[model samples]
Target: MKIKYAIIGAGPTGLGAARRLNELGEKSFIVLEKNSYAGGLASSFTDEKGFTWDIGGHVVFSHYEYYDNLLVEILVDEYLEHQRESWVKSGKVWVPYPFQNNIRYLPNQKKWECVRGLLPGERSEEEPANFFEWIINTFGKGIADHFMLPYNFKVWATYPEMMSFSWIGERVSVIDLKTVIKNILLERDQLSWGPNNTFRFPLKGGTGSIYRNLAETLSNHILYNTSVVSVDQKNKIITDSLGNTFEYEFLLSTAPLDILVTKWLEKSPETLINAADMLKHNGVIVVGIGISTSKKDSRCWMYFPDDNSPFYRVTNFHNYSPNNTPVPGQGRALMCEVSYSEHKFVDQNKVVDDVEEGLVTTAMIDDEDRKNIISRWSINVNYGYPIPCLQRDEALKILQPALESMDIYSRGRFGGWKYEVSNMDHSVMQGVEWAERMITGQPETTYRIS
Candidate 1:
């Protein structure tokens, strides 16, 4: 097949690109998706027991007006809006989300330790050298020791020293000691912090429903169950696993950048080969535990920094949408996430059993409530988050330009290799912006090649 544009992967990015191409009345384009379904990392599945599970914790919140307006047009009233209710469980104490801002709930001894580290003379005055140093510099040693360090390590599954803190932008809450102390003195809660403080979820299907619906609108232009194994950039040809080929003027790849450079390219250069090596990432195992009517917990999700939980984060899925359970509002769906990488290892076969035990150990569920467990569903994804190591920007600078020179563009979570702009909205906008740039003379905003 030959086309003006060839989009790989039907996740938010590809779907957004294809959808925009259709909107712009561009006819010569095709979307190739490896999965039987759309949504990629944002996809979901319903088990035999009828519990729906998203690949990871995904909430609908937007930073762009275009994305906000897009969701309104797509989902209409088919979603639920909720104030973000998130918490962190540490030292057997439940602190509100942004653990640093709500240290008042900590035990007195530990609470004072957190405050002492934030004192004027306590924090290091040096500019942070890495993510670990940034944590210490911003939150002080007390908060770092008690929450930030361990919690971040658990989530990233990569050592902080190996990461760059440039991506924290709005993902983290940088609070002043005065705010922390004032909240403690007044016993107040600071729950709102990030862009997701107010978010939405599909009323019935899991988070994937939005993308799945978008894919449906572009079905005629999509080739499902197809995987591209090689790209002859010199000749502008793409070859899939079945040996089928596509000739294109421009190609958009939403696959992992490392794989694209090292594996898919016909002749990868030594420079590109070394650059791909610097790109690091972790895997994620989302374990979904659905039970019969456990005591209600209003918090949307909770973070676990201690060994009490084998998972780093757990979401109250049923609270997001009762349809996540077999019968609406009849039970609880606890979606647990555990990240793994070279720096961290998790035994997959025993993880579910370990998660169940961790749930009890962390007091997320009562010891006797195991009998109410009705369903267990899990998905293991190899390319979870793109770790923002010190070499990321340098690597992207090299990889992106080389591919663009060959009329190929890679953008998405792993495609762009940027965790900061890898959210659903950002991924979609990357695609939308890319499509506009291609069809018109407009310059892209979301994923730039600079």
Candidate 2:
């Protein structure tokens, strides 16, 4: 039977689009997943000791009501809510997030520089061209110099000056200058900022469970372990790795835009080539360490921006949910260390060893803790986070229309390629909105937000 819609990539975004179609009483669709599982990066895994780890560190934080409603509808009682408590390790001090607002912890000289930078001067007559300038203008030279510049370079694998600031919306927190000064003088913490003050997590499984359950709802329509080998856009047909072919009236692709254009489109449209060229991404090395420890109170994920640690972030997987790892009575702890790099040939064993050494050097885990090390493994995911470069807008402006002309809707983390809306909820909504737009000719949230 010919399908009304063929959705590729069965991640949250694809599943979300399917779910929305089902809710709207439209069932003439099928989902194609490259992996055997439903969740993409959000998927979970188990080690020999029954310790669970997510692809990276995924926290469930939503900005849209639709995401919240859909997650609740699918997971229901299985969901576990978590209070967001995060800290940044800077200059041998654990400063609370919104690191700018809490600069009292910094040395007096640094603090004075930050305050001085905040002092309003003749505003630059020219538009801030790069992300660094944009950040310096938005948060003052203080915060940018102290944390934003160095930390972002590590995260993006590119200099901030090379990126564009157009993507910044509600993603980064900008401190209230008056409040920051007051807090500094009073030596008090700035309590309020940003959208995700509190968030939710799935209790039984990791964040992937939510996507897994969502896929279960559309099980009949989803075809797993089916990789799309090629697409005949002119003929509206998709051929899988197994040599099976399927035709569709509309194609909604959640695959990375570059891969889709280079592999499927075949013809190098100027827009497609430019989009492919303008895009850059960072790969993630997720290191999961399982140790036998009884310490239960250290709950929140910690951020490391210092050169001492190779990881940018470390999530206490067990704290997110008791079920995330082995039972407490069984005596085990799971910690995830995230490292970002563009080079693919970096030694995995060496990275893992370096991470282990760094953990001890930073006093995150003691040397004696190594005795309880039962299982350790690393997952390397390429195209983990898309970088919003200086030429992204121009690239997208050309690429979006080209895809639309072919009746193809590209949406998701790397599909639409907008970091601001790349979270699970946002990615899912991108799929839903794209499908809705395809069916009803409505405007899509992904493009509209940009």
Candidate 3:
């Protein structure tokens, strides 16, 4: 008897799994997407003026060759490779990224404080119990106290002490003392240190184009506007929102683990319930501002670590592609700003006003620049960045095996609930590898930290 499979969620992970199944001649599958379209959090939308904006902001950085190979196969001729130019805005200083390494730009007293914190001392035999301790140990107290602690609070919407350090492998950069001193002495900007030194973006049609291409490949098997409302693991049946039921031999769920356990499992475990309650996520408010300036050259994305700006980051969406906004002769530049918070009941009008005020305060736009404002729109995503809080690992440890026991594999950014491997490339490869594992019982590289 042939094995039948049913995939829940039409995001990158589910699509990847479907692609892999197709390649292996396994046609016994159906993709159920809740939304009217594909690409979960990574989807795109166009405003009334034809400007393209992503859900928040997404960039593709891959560590796996298979991921790259598959993208090349699908995207074919529709991708643009870009070098990353990122910076942190602290106070009035435009410090280079890995702000700790560029402390020479700081005051002498602060510099000395950092050095004092780094003096070789009695190392703790025990491991760091929280994110704050881990950062202090890795970058010293100066960097952590000055930037890491405060900036992270703004971004993650949680206190550092409340977060765990187990997710800090390649996600956070660990500065080398020798290199730091050398760069500071030489007054050099260490631009080539991290995983995102060079990356790719879709040349046209925005980041969603990649997903659109993936969906095009499996157009026949994908079922849009079909939301999975419940699942009966014991009976191997999934009921859609429209009251249609489908049976399968295997299940791949990319939905939130909390919802799956609460609604699908036979006897939801108390441990899983507790884990769900512990899981905390930050919401994102993405504001797209279209201006009427001829300044063709602007930084790709700027980091706002200062209090003046409510947004944590801003991407010059037009810089990615001319098509991302109106044409140069026809219109002006476009900027997309992202703000994160844990609360869901934030007033939309208030957020818009705050964002506009922040843009002017940060000097991204002038006070009298209303003439340049051609269009403005906003999108709010409830699950933006997965907070690596102290309880995250405990939740995953208990929830992952429970889902697996029901023959359901959940993978992707929100699916696995991992921010470390939640980039476009990582999420897509997660889907690919999950399929390979299910087909051949192979180990998944994305799940392995080393």
For each candidate, C-alpha RMSD in Å?
Answer: 0.9, 2.2, 2.7
lDDT of 3 at 369: 67
In order, the Cα lDDT scores of the candidates are 0.91, 0.80, 0.77
Per candidate, the number of residue pairs that clash is: 0, 0, 0
Candidate 2: regions farther than 4 A off: 122-126, 329-334, 341-346
lDDT of 1 by residue, 317-421 (tens): 988998999988888899999999999999999999999999999988886678889898888999889999999999999889988888889999999999989
In candidate 1, which residue ranges exceed 4 Å CA deviation?
Answer: none
Q: Between prediction 2 and prediction 3, which has the larger lDDT?
A: 2
* Per-residue lDDT of candidate 3, residues 1-450 (tens digit): 123888888888889889988987888898989888888888888787778888766787788887788889878877778887777776767776767777767667776776666667722335788988887887777777777887787778777888888777777777756766777689887666578877788877788888888898998888899888778788888888889888888888888767787776666778788887777788778888777565644467777766777787878777777777766344544454554565324566677778777888877777666567877888887777788888888788888887788887778887788888887778777888888887788889886422
Give the number of the best model, judged by lDDT.
1
- Deviation in Å, model 3, residue 34 alpha carbon: 1.0
- Each prediction's TM-score versus the true structure: 0.99, 0.94, 0.92
Error of 1 at 251 (Å): 0.4
Per-residue C-alpha lDDT of model 2 across residues 47-130, encoded as one tens digit per residue: 787888888878888878898888788788887777777777887777887788788888788788777777768234368999
Name every residue pair that clashes in candidate 3: none
